[model samples]
Target chain A: MEAEAARPDRRAERAAARRRRDRRGFAIAAASTVLVIGGLTALILTSSGWPAVRETFFNATVFKESFPDVAKAFWLDIRVFLIVEVAVLALGLLVALIRTSRAAAMFPLRLLAILYADIFRGIPTILLVYLIGFGIPALANSDAEGSSTLSWLPTEPVVLGAIALTLSYGAYVSEVYRAGLRSVHPGQRDAALAIGLTERQAMRHVVIPQAVRNVGPPLLNDFISLQKDVALIAIIGVTGEAFQVAQIMASTDFNYTPLLCAAVLYMAVTIPLARMLDRWDRGRVR
Target chain B: MSGTPVIAIEGVTKAFGDRGVLRGIDLEIAEHEAVAVIGASGSGKSTLLRCVDLLIEIDDGDILLDGEVITDPAADPVAVRRRLGFVFQAYNLFPHLNVIDNVTLGITRAHGLGREDAREAARATLARFGLEGREEESPSNLSGGQQQRVAIARAFATRPRAMLLDEVTSALDPELVGEVLRAVRDLKQEGVTMLIATHEMGFAREVADKVGFLHEGRLVEVGPPEQVLEDPRDPETQRFLRRLLEAGRA
Candidate 1:
């Protein structure tokens, strides 16, 4: 009789535990569902005018007319992105190396990197673009008579856009690389030292490879952000490939159709890359 | 003992954040001596070994390795560390590199061995530690015993004058402990001057030439393994031995 009585109490405790777990799981599921629904509603309301959206997005004539100019602009964007990203990656790595190194000389470089990251991350990218595009050019024009070097270097929209993006993203990516460096286990460094590798050799052979692998997803995400950010270059009125096409179509029809079309083009490029990143992240998690 | 002492620590003091871990540790390890440091956790055995290798900077003492004062502020720590190998309580195998790469990394970089030669040397060392044909396997994929062996192989591959084993077998399963100990015993037979911090009294009794007991950051006792283990003169040493024996028996 005592055993029977205790059995029911034990069963009750187990049921309560199960109920608690179920409640927690349900809460998580409900929260995720609400978030998804909210996002979907926002997307639907923003894109509610289907006919206008369709005309802007799927109109074959508009796409065909803009194709050549859009292709050129797209290529230009790619060039800017590639150059900026490569430069940022190289500089960020160098800064990360300096940040991690014990050498007293690297202390100044480390501080500079920290300051750069703080300043660039704090400022608006638009402000940086304006500063480089308009402010620098205006300042240079004033001094053009005295400084041939300053005058000779083109402050064209493309050049300014590239420089702005590079500086801004370079600062951000340096932090990413720094995080990657920090993620490397101190034990691994000690192990390398024990086996007779110098600090630099240990970093190059053991630490950096692991750090790069660890930061792969974040690095990819940064690349995608940079890709979309190329649109910011449109503000300068340089009218390269994408902008020229958008301007011609918008002017012809006096509609925002061309801008929407360009947005879709961007989605087309970035969506696939984003999906690849998602898959890579999932693989890493598993 | 034909050559000079492989490692000599005199008046070595190490502290972490105002807490002195090694308070003026003075010891000499002859060439090819296998000295075991047995102590409770945080008793400064590990710190003493690290100081000898110049991994941890000494606060106020000098460490002479191969007749050179490694603890000298002017000495290059990297150069000093190149002559000694260390294994940690948690095997610090490079997870990114497979066993072969982990072992060959130092040899290739520090000694300037060509890739083929380094790989060859690494292969031989790995084979000795029963890691043959496992060169391509990542340390993460290997079992704990295998990983520890790979770490040991990595250290031994460098051909250092001395090896410091900081509780190498502590993290292994009881069944797995033998394989690592066997590897250490093999290293001992090869005349590697070793300072091993271990909790395994049986292994220390069986294999160590000398055993030292550390208590509260002090080397409280040092003598032959039988004398230290069986006939401890210090009360703290006896109590520690008793507890360890009881735990092992349990």
Candidate 2:
């Protein structure tokens, strides 16, 4: 309160105290991490099945051997992931736009978008994979009179799996997009419209950019989920993605080491994405 | 007030659900005239301005821009809005855009000017408003008064035929209100056709050629500022002014 207390050196003294407090906080965090890791290692080593468990799941030799095969198979998952993720983003945005359309002419499309989200979101992803993967092929082959109408559909298990994932995730991501769209203050769009931009032009330049920026974290979360769900294609029983290869190796060698490798691969991809999204969210807040 | 009417509102009615905000309002603004509508909060002054801009569609009657029925269902609201400028009470500058970009958006996107040319024009407009080196700064970073000035700059940059300012200074701090009112005063001096809604009685009296008093969604009285402010005939208008005087807001 006094002018004497507001001296320039007092500011530096307070800043130094703040730095010391931060250093203490960092020390506590490091100590806790070390303690937790130490406790986990001690528990794992002292377990009765430690040697056999290590051999079956954490075997260095088996890990090395399975790494190449699992890594190679993961590329297929990555391909499906990349393709489906892009398709999902586009489909989600389209569906979200349709659902939010205020025009009477778009009623049917809006209803269809609503229906797609409801049905696809309700159906389990694995079941969708089975139905599309096996059902479409069966339908195409069925010599029943008018069933050949489905012949143009891709019967390949991987492609069907991708389509199924696209539909399922598209439903989910559309909601994310919708929430983002709605999260933007109506005033922003009003300002754009007041300046004479058409609804679509305003949405494209102003609303969508802000909405997408707002939903960046959730979109990244969905992408990470999508990356992991690429393994779900293995449920179709044919495509040799990382999970399927891991399953095959586990069955053949009676060891789960290959599964561990696949798990590690997934974490490698997802953890970085999660971290990047967190950074982006924090940067925006800052 | 002289020349032909630039904006003509005829029996324009607007309602939100069952609550009518504007009750068959009729008003007209001549070219190069400055008309200020003053009233208590929720007196439909804002609704009137928004209706003219087509931001809020009127439920009944017609609005004309330069003698053409802009409220006719066939007219393109975007095209009509392109020819008119508006400043909101909240100074709704795009938070994602810097000051210059916010000012230039209308020219580049709506008026079909090239982006580079719009930017050049926006910079000059910002400079005219004493924001020369602040073009690249986001509006959120500016003070409330500066932000409102930028909003005014954005409205001015389009070279619109007429301008609508809806309670532009009502959201500002007491100290900041002067700068915004000064900008509006500057616009008035340039002979811009303006229909302004304000709670600032002194500014309205100084800047307005004509003043209208709105009460319960109806224009109770309208005339020259001297007549409306000094010699209001309606009891509601008298009571409104008396309340303002008691609050020391008049």
Candidate 3:
């Protein structure tokens, strides 16, 4: 009788095993959810400042009233981010290709690229914004006695901010591209050359394609970061973007709801991108 | 055995920094003949093949193709390599390209064939090598034997003047070795001039018109297969064959 029960009917046995696994998973999830909710309730009840914190940060009416202005300013933030992201990727790739050039004549170009990456990457982003925003215009106006020869240079606050962001972000992204380029196996290059492809053709057809593929996930991380850093433009007094508008609103109303609104908007865009990139990462491994 | 030489390596020498790999090596391949070089690892057999293919720059002397000096500084290595087909021990097929794409890359790029014509030629070549239905599959999906054959097909599709195979079967499973060697045998029967560096002693002896034994960056013995394999004159060649014999490889 015992032997008969043990005799394998494979489908039925597999079904029973799956049911047991599902039940175990459900039990663990239920216990964990209860613990989290219990801990959160205890913390809220025991804290002395909970009411004050709630009144200042989570006022629903303030959230409702501040939503429109914050939402409007967010479009400007999005626009700047889109433009800067494209500029950063293109400039970064150009610098990386030059840095990795194999020709003897490209030594000077390679050195320039190395210096650019090191210098821009060392300085903080806010300092770069301040310097580019105030320094360039100030230099153009420094010669007060004569006609400013550099009048043709851009003095707009938004343009200067975009330039600052691009320069800073470009340096970091170029390193990412360089790492990807180096990760390609030397054997791939050898095979390409052995088949009569010129060095340029080999890089164009074989090396760059593999390099770009390898760097896709890390590129997304840089992109999400660039999206967040768009807020730093508020420092340069670009009053059209969300963070600047939120700062003004908070100072006038003495409520932080506008800042919270801006935070929510940023998370709204970034969380979806992060999740999408996670999916891409999983698919690549499979 | 006597026609205009397809490839001739004249007193070629190469070194990596301080260590000399190929010291004053000379070789010649006549029309429709197979020359095999056999030696232990690191004996410069592969370097000799690489020098002929122009993958490595020779330190001294020159290589000639069809009475033209191809190793001159002015000679375009790209043009010279286009006339030669080379396969490596590891079967370095591009991972991103499918079988047909890999086979057709040289055809389209170097041979200047249009996309449609290159694809047609690639398909016929793949079919000839018993890989007709596998054209669309990535190289990573194939067995080691199949991948090696694809590498051969990629080389043959361009109608190169001569083929250089560097221990093409060294990385394959034992059962897979016969299939690759069979393809080589068919190429020989079809009158392709080939220079092969290999470790398979029995196959080399059976298929090669001439055999050369390399020892320490020099071609120590080179003659007819029977003379070189059956009665090697040099002490290094003798000891090398004796070792292979003791290992049950000869």
Candidate 4:
């Protein structure tokens, strides 16, 4: 009975079993991944059309020629994505707060917030980019001197495109924020109010901080989509971005390898971002 | 206990949809006195507390805090709440905040105390509740009893006019309930006016100046704890006590 306290666990056998279990888990994961992903990769690589597909999609000379320019242009995508993401975050939070506010004075603003979310979220992102990019300039040029719209209304495709991206994503991100705000138990908000915090104070300091914490995963998930959607700008004739440059290179040589190069560049940012989000999520759970 | 009432609930009627929760309930707590409301789970105990805090609106009737009709539609709920502290059963300390922040938030933000002064006051209150050096630890790190104590401290730190304890010890493990009850007893000894909703009949008998029993959304009985717990006139009150005693909870 005295020694039972000292030797509470079968430590040696348990440790060995734990190690064996971990190794078995890892082996199964690796085997299943190899069987599924690797099998698909190998099947495609060995197909009868593999030679032609390789020539068009995986030409090393084409990659070497296109990657440097595409990589350089990818910088534009990174910069715009960062700016748009931050802008969307701020705007989305504002809309969410406005929508969630209960003040009678904020009634009209609340309606506007709802309408803004609905309109922006309803339109396709590419269509929005096209409309804003082409429509604004077209309206401006139609002016007698093109002065007012030229002066204030952005004719630049990139600027217009960025604005469209911000609006479109802001709507979606605001809904995410709203869901986060709602996900927080009503008791927390009640507790905040019980302590004498005003409605605004409760939301800003207590509710918003907690809500933002709740939505971190979904927020990051949206940003990932936004990062890829930055390529939508290229469709509106924005030059010096990855996809457009890749498209130009591919057209010149009729080799699709440049497109693959662009895909790799997009993954370079997205994969690391996804990984960071995952790491943060894990750290939070621990 | 003084003659002046810190909180007075009069003819407070509340209904959710068509089902009534509090049907013309009336109770009062004098300054430095504790009144415990004991009843089964759906007996409107929490609803009474929430109505007094102005957390939920009553369809009819009024509540008075320090002789002012707070349930008047014109009254500011936030200002009314500012003077009273309501502790929830679940110990709703802000998970994102450390223990000290949970206490200091109301003091600094709502009470408008200076940050340093709030911290000093909060430290003293936390220490009084047996949580002195654990100020900066997150609420999640504390055990159930400790967390409830922090919730109590967070409410008490602001020096509220009246403290509302909503089954403060109900959420804790049976073994951990004593420490939280001890904290409430300390408040009672400190002469803090309190309106407590609780399941622990023993705690009520020990700390409360009076105990009220609720049955079917009605205040069926109210008197000194000894009178209410030992000999009750209402059938509902007697039946409730008999059930508790049968379950060995009394």
Please tell me how candidate 1 rates in CAPRI terms. Answer: medium
Two-way TM-score contest, 1 vs 3, winner:
3
Best by lDDT: 4
User: Model 1: clashing residue pairs?
Assistant: A73-A241
- DockQ for every model comes to 0.73, 0.79, 0.72, 0.75
lDDT score at residue A97, model 3, on the 0-100 scale? 98
For all candidates in order, state the fraction of native interface contacts they contain.
0.84, 0.78, 0.67, 0.84
- Count of backbone clashes, every candidate in sequence: 1, 0, 0, 0
Candidate 4 scores a C-alpha RMSD against the true structure in Å of 3.3
Better of 3 and 4 by DockQ: 4
Off by over 4 Å in 1: A1-60, A142-149, B1-3
lDDT measured at residue A215 in model 4 versus the true structure, 0 to 100: 93
Candidate 3 Cα deviation (angstroms), residue B137: 2.2
Flag the better candidate by lDDT, 3 or 4.
4
Worst ten in a row by lDDT for model 3 chain B: B1-10
Residue pairs in candidate 3 whose N, alpha carbon or C atoms collide under 3 angstroms: none
- Poorest stretch of ten by lDDT in candidate 2 chain B: B1-10
Chain A TM-scores of all predicted models = 0.76, 0.89, 0.91, 0.87
Candidate 2 local lDDT, residue B152: 93
Q: Using DockQ as the measure, what is the rank order of every candidate, best first? A: 2, 4, 1, 3
Ranking by lDDT: 4, 2, 3, 1
Q: What is the lDDT of residue A273 in candidate 2?
A: 100
lDDT tens digits, residues A1-286, model 3? 9998888899988999999999999999999999999999889967999887777777899989998999999999999999999999999999999999988999999999999999999999999999998998886773657778887788888999999999999999999999989999987887888888998888888898899889999999999999999998888878879989988888897888789999999999999999989999999999
Clashing residue pairs, candidate 2?
A: none
